[model samples]
Target: MAAERPVPTHEVTNQVPPVVGRDISTSPALLEGLRREGGGWAEDEVRALALLGNSETWQQAGRLANDHPPVLHTHDRYGNRVDEVEYLPQYHDLMRKAVAHGLHGAPWVDPRPGAHVARAAKVVAWGVADAGHLCPISMTYAVVPALRATPELALQYEPLLTNGVYEPALRAPQDKGGLIAGMSMTEKQGGSDVRANTTVAVPAGDGSHRLTGHKWFTSAPMSDLFLTLAQTDAGLSCFLVPRVLPDGTRNAFFLQRLKDKLGNKSNASGEVEYDGATGWLVGEQGRGVATIIEMVNMTRLDCSLMAAGGMRLNVAHALHHATHRSAFGRRLVDQPAMTNVLADLAVDSEAASAVVMRLAGAVDRAMRGDEAERAFRRVALSVTKYQLCKRLAPHTVEALECLGGNGYVEDSGMPRLYREAPLISIWEGSGNVAALDTLRALGREPAAVEAFLAELELAGGADGRYDDALAVLHKELVDLGDPEDLQFRARRVVERMALLLQGSLLIRHGDHAVADAFVASRLAGDRGRDYGTLPSGIDTRAVLARAAVPE
Candidate 1:
């Protein structure tokens, strides 16, 4: 009998190409989006973003996020309670770079015509590299407006907050050159319902209060300060709690345990216990929701921006893989099915970028006292926040599948992105919360709805599909029924409003091919429920070219 022939293993073919070492900021789609959005950042900001895209920076980001998750130090060697969170040096390095790039509070400090747009652009760039560090960056940015409720508090913290310095010490705010802030609003029981918080704040008679409660999720627990919600005699109120008291003593804040999260491992989020921690009231008692909401709105906008950035990165990775990997007889990118999916993903990324930047512009104009823009933002923020964040998870999963098994591995960075995607939806507010907020805004602020519709009308005749979608949305919005009925259909209504707004923005600012494809696939419902299902007639090549990553 002949010996059985043993076959050698075949070489791994059609494997995904390496996606790191590319300049993310200079990617065609991102730059085009930034240019179209009128991001008025100076040369320094542009250079900073480009630097973050370098190979070394990308390597550092990967290393920190994956191998160096934060560690919690609950007690000292001598049995004293230290409650310090220790981070790998890479995390601190990234934080410093982020602060130096003006990502934390640049818009507020600079206050230019398109200040928020500039800041949003930087954040988009940073998010592609690493997202965990942005937790503190975003919280600090959000805290500025809410702190203004108390002039004295704002005056005391503004310089520290605005300074482009990253001081991570758990010292008194007065002693630090800069400060990063965190938020502790959710309790184990309440979740998004801050009104259900069980924390109590007893007056200290000097405009300060002693807070006693626990936070289920306290992000960046080692930060110098936290903006938290607690119950007062009047009602639930916002308070500014520092890690250290004014007399150079440690506050009564205790770290119970760090949360083992799915992603965002580089940042520490923990369960905290406050044993009469000293806190100062930010605004009038009982106006906690209103005051903290100012911060919440800003954070919600960042959430959308981050999701958009993540989508762009996801598409870039997919495009990179397809461009280099060969399947059957041709490059995967050249295959018709792959091209359709890539183009569809590109359209989604570009539309998200356009809408987010437009929202940033609205925020800038509103800050400058543009009532029309402010009204538009009231409705647009919720709409975009709900839709874009919800799009991240499924979009990322589809993008990841483009690389098949390679993407599922930890080294490819795709899994990290997939883990990070759903967080934006859960962060500022979940989908239902955003949908309800949109409905609430429409009902309470008719002017907001009017301004939103007017903005959509700017591109009314550009695409037939868009026009049809807009007509349906308009009818749904205007021919309103009972509040309960509106609430029941809120998600549908918000989704339509988001699609119309995105379509309008793309028509006005995005490439013609990209805009057309978006209208056809998204607004017209000509495609299936997944990515890469674009129709054949659309300019898929143009969309792919625009989305290609810069080497």
Candidate 2:
């Protein structure tokens, strides 16, 4: 009646069955091509298509991000500022392009527990691993692109982005580049212990201040900028101190010495001396903890990614060696024990990656304007950052052991994990700091905690598998919201909270291969429970109180 609208020949053939099943496996020739292409292009295509599929949403977000300027500063590898040269328009353009291209989508659209943030973090970590740098540059990419958002101090810091002394810094030579480029952050006392900071930011009447103190470990000694934290009446406040003058010249800060240490050798750690080093206040007084956290959160997530990447590298090395090495008249891979070891390593790396990704996703979501989901995402991020780093290090070490004597050798790259793994657990916030923070966050925001639990329940966690995990965790947690034996129940209660978050994130973002691996990882907890004994009761309150009470 409608002019036989769909009676076309192709349409008529649609009902016919194929001679055999579709068999989508690649042919040998195509497989070779894919292998030759190194899979990156394919992954990019897949990643791109995923983003393109939601173009309308991301496009809108992009517009929003473009309206705001970035926090531009010239920094060395150690987070110190170099100078305030005019901002480079090219970088602004690139950042805008990254936003337009949907670099931000992974942060918000997927709505993972913490996976989004972790994704941005992973990018930064990869840069660190490859270039031995850690600026959390990827975070700006993720934050602006994904959330279409800007930091609160965007106005104050934006001018430095387009016009700052660091403009030439991005173009500086590698070896002779600025001092802070590949340095690490450290204090004579401790790494993330701001309260323990010995550096003093003494104000000079002209709205500038002199920074005096000794920094034990600093990354990117060649960097032009240092995001140094100091004690203020309000509390710990950070400043955007430059290594050079406003006229693009070197300042008084001196690199006192360099630390010859473990695997991050590609990264040069230095002891720095700042004498009357002038710096600009980054934000309001006493807001150092809050403002610098913008960078710290970014750094912590970066550490998680670095750990994951190291684990991935370790697993890859183990697999390659196992498949190639021979032992006792058989290929090492042929041995059941060796096979199990490799399998376990793969599983651990995969699971840890999944947890990190979920945390990253939550960060992405929060950036995208789901304020209600933000608090939960923050809690989830802290937990994942702590758990993944703690859990994956041992896994990596064990995997390296599968390589036997070879793993210990620096040339093998396995030793790097052992050396650098501590960076994750110690920096940003230590494992203990993270664990206690998770508990404290729950206590401070009970509704968010309940919401987080409800989220787990919604994500296929109502069944025995989820409940069993939670039940095991419950025995260790303390319900601060309710006074009933909360003190005795501290660890388990907090653990359950962690499990709930883990399970929820894994279930929600299980689409990716990484996420799928998490479903399998829950078995580890079960095994640990069966074979391992629950430790003696822990008083989280006391532990937290001790940490809170300063010496």
Candidate 3:
């Protein structure tokens, strides 16, 4: 008998190629943003990181890191109070790369212009490798600014925080080669209302404080230090609590439990019990919010960038999927409906990049003492953070659906993307918190409003729709019937602000096709809430060319 022919049923056919070997740094929008936003000097390194980010090894590393969530070990073999959290090797690899690239606190130390911009671009490009690991990185990046409020603290620790080395072990801050920081602000009584924290801090007489309280959520438990909030005799205050005391003895930072989160599995968030934890004050007593607010703003910028980067990841995956898979006798990308979907996703992704990069530029300038840029950043960062973060969920959903059944599977990585999308919105602050914060800036901060309007006016006459939207936004800003009503309408107003901001940047500096489509679809209100609802006569081909990988 002739040998049986191999079965064709098991053969894979018409499947999309692996999303590897393609450099995400080659994105037209990102490249343009880098050059336009003063990050051109870092282009070569960005490209190199893109190669590593897209490589098969790092992709698998991301998967493995997520698959094996961190475990909390409250004790050692002899039941000693080690208070350690163990992570997979893959998690450490990602952290190592992130710290080595200066994504944590290097910009604060680097006097070069556009350091923040370059850092933002890196967050956008390499962050696709694994977002969960970057949470600690963001907190570390953020803590630097808050530390500046205390000159001695900033002077002593700034060098260690900005060191481009990653040491995962728990050691004395001085003994460690480098350091990672965390935030222990919230408590069980109050989530975002950090002032309600019950943590108590008393003077230790050696200039440090002894802190004792139950912190509801403390991420990166193994971090060398935490910018925690507690109540002193004065009032609410910020404290730097260390895991290991300088004398080689452990601090009383106990990990009660590791939170089983919805996403960001690679990282650990814990319920911490600080039983007389050693601490040092950051900024003045009774000025905790005033001090930490600076750090929150910086972290919010990263949250915005993370949302933008996540959207780009979604589009890249969706485009790659559609480019290769075929149904109905033609490639999915060739079908009018799917073409509209991919192009629409691309347009939004490009807009996200442009706005985020511009915000980074504002931050870099603001750091250099540009008062106008600082004011613009106040309102712009708040609104951009709100919109981009909340927008990522729907964008991820639409992009995932483009893959049919395959997308729902964990192996495809789309499910992880879907899970990660909602995190940034909920983080920093939830939707209401973010929206109300923007309203607060608009209502309470006159300089912020004036600067934001001035920034909008920069794109005047560039697009009729943008001009019209700006006019409407101006009316809405002033026509508040009541405080409660404004709070109720905050989300609506913030969404418009986000759209106009994106439109303004795209029109001024984005690709012509990308800019035109964004203005007509977003500002003109011809588009539906969902992707793929662009109005007729828009150049889908041209819009997609900027987003799609070259054949």
Worst lDDT run of 10 residues, candidate 1, spans 24-33
Off by over 4 Å in 3: 1-6
TM-score, cand. 3 vs. native? 0.98
Compute the lDDT of residue 377 as modeled in candidate 3: 97
- Which of 2 and 3 is ahead in lDDT? 3
- For TM-score, candidate 2 versus 3, the one ahead is 3
Among these predictions, the greatest TM-score belongs to 3
Highest lDDT: give the candidate number: 3
Winner on lDDT (1 vs 3): 3
What's the best-to-worst order under TM-score? Answer: 3, 1, 2
Assess the local accuracy of residue 104 in candidate 2 as a C-alpha lDDT between 0 and 100.
25
Model 2 ranges off by over 4 Å: 1-42, 45-131, 135-186, 328-330, 461-463, 472-478, 481-500, 507-551
Q: 366-461 in candidate 1: lDDT tens per residue?
A: 888999999999999999999999999999999999988889998788888898889899998899999999988888889999999999999988
Report how far off residue 289 is in candidate 2 (Å): 1.4
Q: Candidate 3 at 393: error in angstroms?
A: 0.3
lDDT (tens digit, per residue) of candidate 2 on 402-498: 7788788755545655666666677567776777667777668766676566666666543455666665554544434564455445444554565
